[model samples]
Target: MLNGLKVGDKAPIFEGLDQNGKKISLKDYKGKKVVLYFYPKDNTPGCTAEACNLRDNNTLLAEKGYQVVGVSIDSVESHKKFETKFELPFPLIADIDKKIVEQYGVWGEKKFMGRTFDGTHRTTFLIDEKGIIAHIIDKPKTKDHYNQIIETWEK
Candidate 1:
Protein backbone atom coordinates (compact mmCIF):
# COMPACT_ATOMS: atom_id res chain seq x y z
CA MET A 1 0.00 0.00 0.00
CA LEU A 2 1.30 3.40 -0.92
CA ASN A 3 1.55 5.39 2.29
CA GLY A 4 1.54 7.89 -0.55
CA LEU A 5 1.47 11.11 1.45
CA LYS A 6 1.76 12.20 5.05
CA VAL A 7 1.66 15.28 7.17
CA GLY A 8 4.62 17.60 6.48
CA ASP A 9 4.92 16.29 2.91
CA LYS A 10 4.28 18.53 -0.05
CA ALA A 11 0.91 17.86 -1.65
CA PRO A 12 0.98 16.31 -5.10
CA ILE A 13 -0.17 18.51 -7.97
CA PHE A 14 -3.03 17.32 -10.14
CA GLU A 15 -5.21 18.80 -12.88
CA GLY A 16 -8.73 17.56 -13.53
CA LEU A 17 -12.15 18.66 -14.72
CA ASP A 18 -14.74 19.89 -12.26
CA GLN A 19 -18.47 19.20 -12.39
CA ASN A 20 -19.10 21.91 -14.97
CA GLY A 21 -16.12 20.84 -17.08
CA LYS A 22 -13.97 23.61 -15.73
CA LYS A 23 -10.29 22.78 -15.40
CA ILE A 24 -9.04 22.69 -11.80
CA SER A 25 -5.48 22.47 -10.64
CA LEU A 26 -4.12 22.20 -7.13
CA LYS A 27 -1.42 24.63 -8.15
CA ASP A 28 -4.00 27.35 -8.56
CA TYR A 29 -4.51 27.44 -4.78
CA LYS A 30 -0.83 28.09 -4.10
CA GLY A 31 -1.23 30.83 -1.56
CA LYS A 32 -4.35 29.51 0.15
CA LYS A 33 -5.04 26.57 2.41
CA VAL A 34 -7.03 23.76 0.81
CA VAL A 35 -9.43 21.27 2.31
CA LEU A 36 -9.22 18.46 -0.24
CA TYR A 37 -11.59 15.66 0.69
CA PHE A 38 -12.26 12.35 -1.06
CA TYR A 39 -15.39 10.31 -0.61
CA PRO A 40 -16.54 6.90 -1.87
CA LYS A 41 -19.28 7.79 -4.38
CA ASP A 42 -21.98 10.23 -5.30
CA ASN A 43 -25.43 10.31 -3.69
CA THR A 44 -24.79 7.36 -1.40
CA PRO A 45 -26.07 7.81 2.19
CA GLY A 46 -22.83 8.35 4.06
CA CYS A 47 -21.24 10.13 1.14
CA THR A 48 -24.18 12.47 0.83
CA ALA A 49 -24.10 13.36 4.50
CA GLU A 50 -20.36 13.95 4.44
CA ALA A 51 -20.64 16.09 1.32
CA CYS A 52 -23.47 18.16 2.74
CA ASN A 53 -21.46 18.79 5.87
CA LEU A 54 -18.65 20.20 3.82
CA ARG A 55 -21.05 22.06 1.58
CA ASP A 56 -22.72 23.68 4.56
CA ASN A 57 -19.38 24.78 5.90
CA ASN A 58 -18.04 25.95 2.55
CA THR A 59 -18.51 29.57 3.42
CA LEU A 60 -16.85 29.16 6.81
CA LEU A 61 -13.86 27.52 5.23
CA ALA A 62 -13.75 30.27 2.65
CA GLU A 63 -13.97 32.91 5.34
CA LYS A 64 -10.97 31.26 6.95
CA GLY A 65 -9.19 31.64 3.58
CA TYR A 66 -9.34 27.97 2.83
CA GLN A 67 -10.71 26.48 -0.36
CA VAL A 68 -12.88 23.39 0.03
CA VAL A 69 -13.08 20.83 -2.75
CA GLY A 70 -14.16 17.23 -3.00
CA VAL A 71 -13.01 14.43 -5.30
CA SER A 72 -14.54 11.15 -6.31
CA ILE A 73 -14.55 8.60 -9.10
CA ASP A 74 -18.03 9.69 -10.16
CA SER A 75 -18.47 11.06 -13.66
CA VAL A 76 -19.29 14.65 -14.48
CA GLU A 77 -22.97 13.86 -14.89
CA SER A 78 -23.19 12.19 -11.49
CA HIS A 79 -21.26 15.09 -9.95
CA LYS A 80 -23.65 17.55 -11.56
CA LYS A 81 -26.63 15.70 -10.12
CA PHE A 82 -25.09 15.49 -6.65
CA GLU A 83 -24.12 19.14 -6.65
CA THR A 84 -27.50 20.28 -7.86
CA LYS A 85 -29.31 18.09 -5.38
CA PHE A 86 -27.42 19.33 -2.39
CA GLU A 87 -26.68 22.81 -3.73
CA LEU A 88 -23.00 22.28 -3.01
CA PRO A 89 -21.20 25.55 -3.42
CA PHE A 90 -17.79 24.02 -3.89
CA PRO A 91 -16.55 22.20 -6.94
CA LEU A 92 -16.54 18.44 -7.06
CA ILE A 93 -13.90 17.05 -9.36
CA ALA A 94 -14.79 14.08 -11.52
CA ASP A 95 -12.07 11.49 -11.17
CA ILE A 96 -13.72 8.65 -13.04
CA ASP A 97 -10.40 6.86 -13.50
CA LYS A 98 -9.49 7.34 -9.81
CA LYS A 99 -6.12 8.69 -10.95
CA ILE A 100 -6.16 11.57 -8.48
CA VAL A 101 -7.56 9.41 -5.66
CA GLU A 102 -4.98 6.75 -6.40
CA GLN A 103 -2.22 9.33 -6.45
CA TYR A 104 -3.37 10.59 -3.08
CA GLY A 105 -3.47 6.99 -1.79
CA VAL A 106 -7.18 7.16 -0.97
CA TRP A 107 -8.12 4.55 -3.58
CA GLY A 108 -7.51 0.95 -2.67
CA GLU A 109 -8.94 -2.18 -1.17
CA LYS A 110 -12.24 -1.58 0.63
CA LYS A 111 -14.82 -3.86 2.15
CA PHE A 112 -18.38 -3.67 0.88
CA MET A 113 -20.94 -6.25 2.03
CA GLY A 114 -17.88 -8.03 3.41
CA ARG A 115 -16.45 -8.31 -0.09
CA THR A 116 -13.29 -6.55 -1.11
CA PHE A 117 -12.94 -4.19 -4.08
CA ASP A 118 -10.80 -1.30 -5.13
CA GLY A 119 -12.43 1.98 -4.14
CA THR A 120 -11.89 5.17 -2.25
CA HIS A 121 -11.34 5.14 1.50
CA ARG A 122 -13.17 8.21 2.72
CA THR A 123 -10.36 10.52 3.80
CA THR A 124 -9.62 14.19 4.12
CA PHE A 125 -6.39 16.09 3.52
CA LEU A 126 -5.64 19.58 4.70
CA ILE A 127 -3.07 21.18 2.46
CA ASP A 128 -1.39 24.34 3.59
CA GLU A 129 -0.60 27.36 1.46
CA LYS A 130 2.84 26.06 0.57
CA GLY A 131 1.28 22.83 -0.72
CA ILE A 132 2.42 20.77 2.24
CA ILE A 133 -0.15 18.56 3.87
CA ALA A 134 -0.95 19.69 7.39
CA HIS A 135 -3.25 16.90 8.44
CA ILE A 136 -4.66 13.62 7.15
CA ILE A 137 -8.02 12.46 8.47
CA ASP A 138 -8.48 8.82 7.66
CA LYS A 139 -11.92 7.33 8.32
CA PRO A 140 -13.47 10.69 8.98
CA LYS A 141 -16.85 10.83 10.70
CA THR A 142 -19.50 12.47 8.56
CA LYS A 143 -20.94 14.57 11.38
CA ASP A 144 -17.68 15.68 12.94
CA HIS A 145 -15.76 16.43 9.76
CA TYR A 146 -16.47 20.12 9.41
CA ASN A 147 -15.88 20.86 13.06
CA GLN A 148 -12.63 18.94 12.85
CA ILE A 149 -11.60 20.97 9.83
CA ILE A 150 -12.37 24.20 11.61
CA GLU A 151 -10.43 23.03 14.66
CA THR A 152 -7.53 22.16 12.42
CA TRP A 153 -7.44 25.66 11.00
CA GLU A 154 -7.53 27.17 14.46
CA LYS A 155 -4.42 25.30 15.46
Candidate 2:
Protein backbone atom coordinates (compact mmCIF):
# COMPACT_ATOMS: atom_id res chain seq x y z
CA MET A 1 0.00 0.00 0.00
CA LEU A 2 1.11 3.60 -0.59
CA ASN A 3 0.42 4.40 3.04
CA GLY A 4 0.38 7.77 1.30
CA LEU A 5 2.39 10.15 -0.83
CA LYS A 6 2.90 12.80 1.80
CA VAL A 7 3.20 16.55 1.46
CA GLY A 8 6.55 17.69 0.04
CA ASP A 9 7.28 14.44 -1.72
CA LYS A 10 7.92 14.65 -5.41
CA ALA A 11 4.77 13.89 -7.34
CA PRO A 12 5.08 10.69 -9.27
CA ILE A 13 5.68 11.13 -12.97
CA PHE A 14 3.46 9.26 -15.37
CA GLU A 15 2.82 9.06 -19.09
CA GLY A 16 -0.35 7.29 -20.04
CA LEU A 17 -3.01 7.33 -22.73
CA ASP A 18 -6.21 9.22 -22.24
CA GLN A 19 -9.73 8.27 -23.22
CA ASN A 20 -9.12 10.01 -26.54
CA GLY A 21 -6.04 7.87 -27.11
CA LYS A 22 -3.77 10.86 -26.63
CA LYS A 23 -0.77 10.60 -24.38
CA ILE A 24 -0.80 12.57 -21.12
CA SER A 25 2.10 13.07 -18.80
CA LEU A 26 2.19 14.36 -15.26
CA LYS A 27 5.05 16.63 -16.28
CA ASP A 28 2.80 18.20 -18.91
CA TYR A 29 0.59 19.40 -16.10
CA LYS A 30 3.42 21.00 -14.19
CA GLY A 31 3.22 24.67 -13.13
CA LYS A 32 -0.38 24.04 -12.16
CA LYS A 33 -2.06 22.37 -9.27
CA VAL A 34 -3.11 18.86 -10.22
CA VAL A 35 -5.61 16.54 -8.70
CA LEU A 36 -4.77 12.98 -9.63
CA TYR A 37 -7.34 10.50 -8.42
CA PHE A 38 -7.12 6.75 -8.68
CA TYR A 39 -10.10 4.49 -8.74
CA PRO A 40 -10.55 0.74 -9.15
CA LYS A 41 -12.60 0.80 -12.33
CA ASP A 42 -15.01 2.82 -14.41
CA ASN A 43 -18.84 2.62 -14.33
CA THR A 44 -18.91 0.92 -10.98
CA PRO A 45 -21.26 2.71 -8.58
CA GLY A 46 -18.74 4.31 -6.27
CA CYS A 47 -16.34 5.10 -9.07
CA THR A 48 -19.15 6.62 -11.11
CA ALA A 49 -20.27 8.80 -8.25
CA GLU A 50 -16.74 9.90 -7.47
CA ALA A 51 -16.06 10.75 -11.10
CA CYS A 52 -19.36 12.63 -11.32
CA ASN A 53 -18.40 14.67 -8.31
CA LEU A 54 -15.15 15.61 -9.97
CA ARG A 55 -16.99 16.32 -13.21
CA ASP A 56 -19.57 18.59 -11.62
CA ASN A 57 -16.94 20.41 -9.65
CA ASN A 58 -14.50 20.65 -12.51
CA THR A 59 -15.37 24.17 -13.51
CA LEU A 60 -14.79 25.46 -10.04
CA LEU A 61 -11.61 23.51 -9.78
CA ALA A 62 -10.41 25.02 -13.04
CA GLU A 63 -11.36 28.46 -11.88
CA LYS A 64 -9.21 27.73 -8.85
CA GLY A 65 -6.42 26.69 -11.21
CA TYR A 66 -6.49 22.99 -10.51
CA GLN A 67 -6.54 20.32 -13.19
CA VAL A 68 -8.48 17.27 -12.14
CA VAL A 69 -7.64 13.91 -13.67
CA GLY A 70 -8.96 10.44 -12.99
CA VAL A 71 -6.87 7.30 -13.37
CA SER A 72 -7.70 3.63 -13.48
CA ILE A 73 -6.39 0.39 -14.91
CA ASP A 74 -9.23 0.37 -17.42
CA SER A 75 -8.52 0.61 -21.12
CA VAL A 76 -8.81 3.86 -23.07
CA GLU A 77 -12.01 2.61 -24.66
CA SER A 78 -13.58 2.07 -21.26
CA HIS A 79 -12.57 5.57 -20.18
CA LYS A 80 -14.21 7.01 -23.26
CA LYS A 81 -17.54 5.42 -22.44
CA PHE A 82 -17.40 6.52 -18.83
CA GLU A 83 -16.53 10.09 -19.80
CA THR A 84 -19.35 10.23 -22.31
CA LYS A 85 -21.85 8.75 -19.89
CA PHE A 86 -20.93 11.27 -17.21
CA GLU A 87 -20.36 14.26 -19.51
CA LEU A 88 -17.01 14.71 -17.85
CA PRO A 89 -15.06 17.76 -18.95
CA PHE A 90 -11.61 16.63 -17.86
CA PRO A 91 -9.27 13.96 -19.10
CA LEU A 92 -9.25 10.46 -17.67
CA ILE A 93 -6.05 8.47 -18.00
CA ALA A 94 -5.97 4.82 -18.98
CA ASP A 95 -3.48 2.92 -16.81
CA ILE A 96 -3.90 -0.58 -18.13
CA ASP A 97 -0.44 -1.72 -17.02
CA LYS A 98 -0.95 -0.34 -13.49
CA LYS A 99 2.47 1.30 -13.60
CA ILE A 100 1.27 4.74 -12.60
CA VAL A 101 -0.95 3.16 -9.98
CA GLU A 102 2.00 1.39 -8.43
CA GLN A 103 4.24 4.44 -8.63
CA TYR A 104 1.81 6.60 -6.73
CA GLY A 105 1.26 3.75 -4.33
CA VAL A 106 -2.47 3.64 -5.03
CA TRP A 107 -2.51 0.02 -6.15
CA GLY A 108 -2.64 -2.32 -3.21
CA GLU A 109 -4.44 -4.92 -1.18
CA LYS A 110 -8.08 -4.11 -0.60
CA LYS A 111 -11.00 -5.89 0.97
CA PHE A 112 -14.06 -6.20 -1.22
CA MET A 113 -16.93 -8.54 -0.45
CA GLY A 114 -14.73 -9.92 2.31
CA ARG A 115 -12.12 -11.03 -0.21
CA THR A 116 -8.77 -9.38 -0.54
CA PHE A 117 -7.48 -8.31 -3.91
CA ASP A 118 -4.90 -6.04 -5.44
CA GLY A 119 -6.63 -2.98 -6.84
CA THR A 120 -6.67 0.81 -6.78
CA HIS A 121 -7.50 2.05 -3.32
CA ARG A 122 -9.48 5.20 -4.10
CA THR A 123 -6.58 7.61 -3.58
CA THR A 124 -6.23 11.24 -4.55
CA PHE A 125 -3.09 13.32 -4.68
CA LEU A 126 -2.91 17.09 -4.75
CA ILE A 127 0.26 18.09 -6.48
CA ASP A 128 1.32 21.69 -6.25
CA GLU A 129 2.70 23.82 -9.04
CA LYS A 130 6.17 22.69 -8.08
CA GLY A 131 5.18 19.09 -8.84
CA ILE A 132 5.40 18.10 -5.23
CA ILE A 133 2.55 16.41 -3.44
CA ALA A 134 0.76 18.95 -1.24
CA HIS A 135 -1.81 16.62 0.19
CA ILE A 136 -3.15 13.10 -0.06
CA ILE A 137 -6.64 11.77 0.39
CA ASP A 138 -6.32 8.06 0.92
CA LYS A 139 -9.81 7.42 2.14
CA PRO A 140 -11.67 8.92 -0.79
CA LYS A 141 -15.45 9.17 -0.84
CA THR A 142 -17.83 9.02 -3.77
CA LYS A 143 -18.94 12.63 -3.31
CA ASP A 144 -17.55 16.05 -2.40
CA HIS A 145 -13.98 14.84 -2.27
CA TYR A 146 -13.33 17.49 -4.88
CA ASN A 147 -14.79 20.08 -2.59
CA GLN A 148 -12.75 18.70 0.26
CA ILE A 149 -9.65 19.13 -1.83
CA ILE A 150 -10.56 22.70 -2.68
CA GLU A 151 -11.07 23.36 0.97
CA THR A 152 -7.70 21.93 1.75
CA TRP A 153 -6.17 24.11 -0.93
CA GLU A 154 -7.79 27.15 0.63
CA LYS A 155 -6.05 26.42 3.91
- Clash number for every model? 0, 0
Error of 2 at 139 (Å): 1.1
lDDT of 2 by residue, 5-69 (tens): 67889987899999999999998997999999898999999999999988888888999899998
- What lDDT is reached at residue 32 by model 2? 96
Q: List the residue pairs that clash in candidate 2.
A: none
Residue 49 error for model 2, in Å?
0.6
Each model's C-alpha lDDT?
A: 0.89, 0.89
Residue 29, candidate 1: Cα error in Å is 0.7
Deviating ranges (above 4 Å) for candidate 1 = none
| TM-score, structure 2 vs. true | 0.96
Residues 9-122, model 1: lDDT tens digits:
989898888999998999989999999999989999999999888888888878889898899999999999999999999889999887899889988888889899988999
